[model samples]
Target: MSADSTHAVEKDDAVFHLPGHPLPALVTLDSTDGSGVDLFMLSLRRPVLLNLFSMPVRDGRVDLPSVAQHECAQQLRSVNAELDALKQQMPELAVLGLSLHAPECLRRVREDLQLRFELLSDQQRAWTDKLELPLQSQDDGSQALRRCTMLLVEGQVSRLDFPLRQPSEVGRRAIELLRRETGTM
Candidate 1:
């Protein structure tokens, strides 16, 4: 958001432990199963891929007069389509959706998107600040989590994709990484 996102990211002077990472501890989300999942606490004995994202709106910058026509059902469908696409592509890899919205928004996202993967609440953005992850702020002070990916192997962060800056791109590259790691390449 500041000229180039690359410049916004903070670089650590030294490596942080897998568990010590702030985001890891705050990395809680829900899965399609309707159960809570703690990504950091998960036993990643094998390679693990996690993709993070900022939620998108359908009207999507429509700053014009109200559209000629719209329906609640249509809105819900639109969101579900996107969510389904993400869920399908992000499987096997720990897919995470981080939002910079009010907790109220999460409920709406869950109901409207029919979301499958659990979502992380960056409402206060306490976790983002702790990790120094680059994020842009909404007027309300919520942060648009600048997208990134982390790869963990044998319970330690090995290579952080760290640059997969979009949800779809992140998913595509993460699946590719998982395939390579499994020798399915």
Candidate 2:
């Protein structure tokens, strides 16, 4: 239930092994679709990828639901915007937003960050929970998810990123990897 464990102290040590692990069967979130879509189902069609981004700041620090403020939520929005460009660059991979919180809470994060990608709620996060991505919780209990990306080549583990140093450059990197894998680049 808690994503605290996902974020580990040694980011490089983050875990990502899904080849043997069947993808979770939870419902996908579709904020962009504006009608709530199932991301997991979509990924099943092809290769559904994921990247969890931690927020620099949070208002849930002190029951902010009663009193919270918009803070440094632009980071994810920026990344999501880049996803579009990245989409063009990859042209084949479907992007997914694997947030620490379920869609309900992630909804705010998405809105605050102004993200465009399809964000799915890994509630149990059966797949990401043990991955040790990155996390930090406020005294109030609201925690931040770490930053990482998981690539699925035909619904298989193509690559998994743990606390990636430069998610912004992920597009270029994905392009290069795709090129190598598909012999296009």
Best of the candidates, TM-score: 2
* Model 1 residue pairs with clashes: 30-118
lDDT of residue 121 for candidate 2 = 61
Q: Model 1 reaches what TM-score against the true structure? A: 0.52
Question: What overall lDDT goes with each candidate model?
Answer: 0.45, 0.51
Best candidate, lDDT: 2
Error of 2 at 57 (Å): 6.9
Mind giving the per-residue lDDT tens digits that candidate 1 earns over 1-185? 12121221245322223222433564555443445555556625333454444553343332112211222223323333444443344344554555555455555555555655445555565555555655655444445655555555544444444544343355455545454444454
